[model samples]
Target: MITDVEWATFVPSALLLAATPGANQLLTLRNGLRHGLAPAVSASLGRFSAFALMVIAVAAGLGAVLAASEVAFNVIKWCGVAYLLWLGARTVLAAVRGQVAGEMQKTADEGDGKGVRGGLSSWRLGWQEFLVAATNPKALILFAVFLPQFLPRGAKDVAVPLLVLGAAYIRIEFCCACGYAALGSRLQSMGISLRARRWLDALTGVAMLGLAGWLATENH
Candidate 1:
């Protein structure tokens, strides 16, 4: 069990880590700003789901295997880079062509569409968020490497400790996501213009590109 002292240290650190602006947070923010709170919140479930899987993987010791294998790590890293690059490029192109109005209309239509189309849109959003969270090697590293430091001294079996820490992190992250979603949803009432929307997309694209570049430089 984690000590009260440990909890004291961990909570603040966890909050800081969860609040750090990363690709996942950026995605949530964009989703919130673009699609409104409900859809964005729904989409963020994908991210949380991915984190849950990773925590389970860590507890199961797969995280250690992934951490140790350079080949495996590199494979996942490259895939992330590729996906971020492709996604970022698409958004950048849309912004460059001044297609925000058409793109937003299409997204709104898909999000608001009935039955199959709406389901597909929700699934796609969730899947995208999932991929972004899952593909990042840093997440696994968080479990395999960073998390163990918080474990009880001389503790042999790490599963429970990992799960505890993972749960706390996920909980904090969800709160942060909701906060971001609410802020973005508020913009809906303010009636942001298409030009501003284009700039936002462009900004997000550039940030994604930066994150891809950063991920490409990560080492085991």
Candidate 2:
């Protein structure tokens, strides 16, 4: 029952929000550098799994009710917007600090060490990814939109079918996030200078802030 446009609307925003290179992405990058590709991939996978599970659980319990209420939707949307803005601010601050710290590491690695660390720490990355996804109210709202569109009205058993769709969506999303993470790791490996990494962080922060501003100004 989900229309193509609705499905279209769901994927880009959800993936962008999830894949945004901020704390979680940075952590994934760090993990990759510290551990390896396998751990990095696992972290991304775990994080997405968390999102999928949350969407399903929330949908089974409150998806229909929230979908029916415009007021509740507004509340959740504003909360998500605020959170994004906060995250953006933090990213900017982190970038500034990273610039200074990275310089020291650069000197150390160039002089004393053979090379910068390689690979990701799987457990750490996975836990960090899960936390980021779990705490995101916007993620919850995104699912609120997704599940109802796919569900048949007055379905006798909402739970079973909802879970199935949730699993499917999660699989799609997990693959997407992993793809993005892999790309990011490769980019990081391409001798991303400290200056460049800081600049990328700045850009990501700006994008998030702009998105938050747009969300705040939005009527719906």
Clashes of each: 0, 7
Model 2 lDDT per residue over 86-199, tens place: 767876787787853364345335532222333443454566567656555455666767665656656655566656656666766666556655664555566667677676
Which segments of candidate 2 are over 4 A away from where they belong? 1-50, 58-61, 69-75, 97-138, 148-155
Worst 10 residues of 2 by lDDT: 112-121
Candidate 1 lDDT score relative to the true structure? 0.80
For 1-220, candidate 1 gives per-residue lDDT tens digits of 6552277778888888888888888887777767777877888999999999999999999998998899999999999999899888887888889876565655555552221236888899889999999999888878677677777688877788788888888999999998887776565436677788778878888899999999998767
TM-score of 2: 0.63
TM-scores of all models?
0.89, 0.63
The prediction achieving the highest lDDT against the true structure is 1
lDDT of 1 at 215: 94
Clashes of 2: 7
lDDT of 1 at 123: 92
